[model samples]
Each structure stands twice: as C-alpha cells, then as structure tokens.
Target: MINDSELILNADGSIYHLNLKPEDIADTIIFVGDPDRVPEVSKYFDDIEIRKGKREFITHTGHVNGKRLTVISTGIGTDNIDIVLNELDALLNFDFETRNLKSEIKSLDIIRIGTSGSIQGNIAMGTILASEYAIGFDTLMQYYQKPYNSKELEIQEAVIEKFHDLTFKPYVAHASERLLKKFAHDIPKGVTMTAPGFYGPQGRNLRSQNTYPHLIKQANTFKVNGYQITNLEMETAGIYALSNMLGHHAISINAILASRVNETFASNPKEIVDKAIRMVLDRL
Candidate 1:
C-alpha cells in the first residue's frame, strides 16, 4: 500500500498535481510545455471528451477516427516532468481504492512535442528533430538506480573523454522503438541533451556568469557510435528515464527554434510548432 505521504489525492480522488482521474486520460498521451498549447493540439481532434486544468498541468482527451488521444501540458523543465511522469504512472499502475500497487500494470505511450535549440550547425532553423536518444545533463534520475544502460554509458563516456574536466554526469535513454517507428521513422533522428536550466546549464550567459562557458561547444561536438548531440532541451531526459523505469513508451519530437551554433532564433516559431503538431497527429 502507498502511504498517504506519497499518495496524496484530491477530494474527488484525482491525482494531486494533474487533477486528473484515470478515466480522463488516454493510453496515448502527447505532452506540451505551454498550457495554452493544449487547445492548439486538441483542436484537430474529431471529438472533444475531457479537458481539465490545475496549475501548469492541463489535460485534454479526445478522439480522431475512432482512436482516442490525450494531449497534456507539463509546463517546463525536468522538475515539472518529475511530478508529471510519476503521477501519470501512479494513475495507471495503482489501485486507487485500496492505495495498493496494481497486480497488472498498464503501459502508456507518451510523446513530447516541444521546441529546442539546434546544437548542430547543419540541423537548420525551423527544422524538426526526432530524439532517438535523450542525454540528461540534469541529475533528476541520479536518485534512482539502474539509470544508465550500455548506450547511455557509451554516450556519457565519450562526452567525458572530449571534455576531461566536465563535471556533469549525463545519462542517456533511448526513445521507444515502437513509438519511434510509429511517429518519427522517416524523420532525421539525433540525440538530444536535456539541460537543467534555460541559461547557465545550457551554456547561455546573460548578466549571470556560467561556470562552464564552453559546455555547449563541447557537447555539440560529442559523438559516439555515430550518434551526435543534435539539440538541447529541458525535459526529454527526465521523460525518457522515468518512462523507462515505469514501463511506458516515450519519445520527443523537437521543433528547432534556436541555433546555438550561429546564434540565430526563429522569428515565427509558432508556425514551426504547428507543423510539428500536425506531423505528430498524423502519425498518431
């Protein structure tokens, strides 16, 4: 049985942060970073069924061609992802009435559609990157055991060798090949680095100084077994790692909005995001 400390629910018995009951969500979930983007993605749904919002987390479930889908907003950053992923798993994997773990676990298909900065010069602005693997520069998964696999170890070792003095212990996790082939098989695949912050962690220095000024340059040049660090975002790693531990299939489709190599940003990034949404929905 899950303790009350770990399993806090609302008066109506919905999940705390997400404020959603199991019936409100679908097996296939698409996560966005912005709350308002919830409607943008659900607009294409054939029929609207459920819509709920609490804090930065918003959920909308609908159907297309008799197929049900759920689009949810996770706000931003891996911190929010930590809450989102765990709560989501709880909803499916636990017997809420008894507060006991379910004997038969349920697996969900989770896909993150968000914007990212291109670390590779040739990746181009306004392009979409399908994250075959997510490299977590953040330490969100450090508390958990068995976080790194063979592929992840090789990727991190390569980065360490390239930047001998680098301090971050990065972990890599691959996207679900089942979901990858379903949604992003034809697209260009690359590895994504998930930073802890928008600035210093991603090697972006404004008025504040960054300890590792060359972190971005070194990471972009990192490659192992033909996988290159293609872009940077803030949530994919946590999503991939947590999804693996929880037995869910996860993938991230990134819209390239910034060019870290040439220092260029997208002027009308919303258009790019829309394109990505349509692309993912088509596959879904």
Candidate 2:
C-alpha cells in the first residue's frame, strides 16, 4: 500500500492537486495550458457532465459525436506536467480505498492543444503544427528512469555537443506514433524545443540579460536524421516524456502565435488557437 503522504488524496477521495476523481475523466483527454481554454474546447461538447477546478487545474468532461472527451488545463510548464500526469495515472490505475495498483491498468489517449512560437523562418504565425519529437531543455526527465531510443539518443548527443556550454544535458522524447498519424497527417510535423521559461531559456532578452543569448539560433540550426527543431513551447516535452513513462499515448498540437525567428507576434492569436482546437476535435 502506498503511504498517505506519498499519494495524497482529498477528504472527498478525489486526487489532491487536480480535485478530480477517476469517474470524472474520460479515456481520451485534451490538455490546454490555460484554464480559460478548457471551456473553449469543452464548449463544442454536446453535453458536459462534470466541471471541476482547483488551482490551475480545470477539467471538463463531456461527449461529442458519441465519443467521450476530457479537457483539462495544466497551467504552464513541465513541473505542472509532473503533478498532473502522476495524479492522473494514480486516479486511473490505483484503487483509492486500497491505495494499491489495480489488476488491470489502462492507457489513456492524451492530446495537448496548446500555443507555441516558431523558431524556424518557414513556420509562419497561425500555422498549426504537431510535435513529432521534443527536446527538453528542462531537467524534469533527469529525475525519471527514462529509456531513450537510438534516434532520441543520437539527437540528444548532438544537442549536447552543440550546446556544450550549457549546465544541463537536454533529453529527447517523441509523441505517440498512433496519435501523431491519426490527427496530424495533413499538418506540418517537426521536433519541438521545450524551454524551461519564456525569457532567458527561450533566448528572449527584454529587461534581463540572457546567459545563452544564442539559444534560438543554436536550436534552429540543429538537425539530426532529417529532423530539425521547428518550434519552441513550454509543456510538450514534459507531456510526451511523462505520458511515455506512464504507458499513455500522447501528442501536442501547436497553434503558432509567435515567431521567434521573425520576431513577430500573431495579431489574431485566438483565431489560430480556435482553428487548432477545431482541427483536433474534428480528428478526434
């Protein structure tokens, strides 16, 4: 049995951070980084059965075209991803009363409908792209016992060699092939660079000095096995890595709102995001 402190639950028996019970979720889940976007996605649902919120985690579960879906907000970064994914897995695979793993475990289909900034010149603002692979600049994966494939290792090694001056070695994680193929066939797909923060980590220097000012340039020129880092985002790497660890299928669909290379922000960011959301729902 898991210890109380290790697997904390609310007095009402829902998960601690998300305030969600197992019955409140669906097999297919959509993750958005902003809480307000939960309703944006859930509004399309034919019927919303559950609405739950606590902190930055807001969840709405409902059905569309007879297919059940759960849309939830993960707030910002991989740190939140760690909490969200672990709690979600616990909710599904553990017997809350017994605090023991269930005899039968289930894999969830997780799709992240979020916004990103393009690091490459060709990827224009308002374009919807699917993250095929993500290189995590954050150290979230360092705490986990991750098994990297040959391609992932090759890319990671190359990234380490290129950004050798950095304090940490980046890790590579890929999206689920099943989910990628199913939803992103017609859209552009490429590697994503998941930065730890929006400012220095992403090579943005507004009021602060960036230690690694050439971060974007280095990542843009990085290429391995015909795959180049195409976009920059906050959560995809964590989502992909944690999902992989928990035996879940996951993919991130990005709506490009800022162009890092062009140094331009989209005038109609909401329209692009709505387009991406509708695209994913249509595919789902």
Candidate with the greatest lDDT versus the true structure = 2
TM-score of each: 0.97, 0.99
Looking at candidate 1, the ten consecutive residues that score lowest on lDDT are: 143-152
Deviation (Å) of 177 in candidate 2: 0.6
Q: Which stretches of candidate 2 lie over 4 Å from their true place?
A: none
Error of 2 at 133 (Å): 0.3
Q: Quote the positional error of residue 224 for candidate 2 in Å.
A: 1.2
Per-residue lDDT, model 2, residue 138, is 96
After the best TM-score superposition of candidate 2, give how far the Cα of residue 262 lies from its true spot, in angstroms: 0.9
Per-residue lDDT of 1-284 in model 1, one digit per residue for the tens?
88988998999999899999988889999999999999999999999889899999999999977889999999989999999999999998888899999899999999899999999999888998799998888888778764567877887778768767756577778899998889887888899999989989899888987788999888877878898899999999999989988889999999999999999999999999999999999887
Q: Per-residue lDDT of 4-110 in model 2, one digit per residue for the tens?
A: 99999999999999999989999999999999999999999999999999999999999999999999999999999999999999989999999999999999999
Which portions of model 1 show Cα errors greater than 4 Å?
none
lDDT of candidates 1 onward, in order: 0.90, 0.93
lDDT of 2 at 147: 74
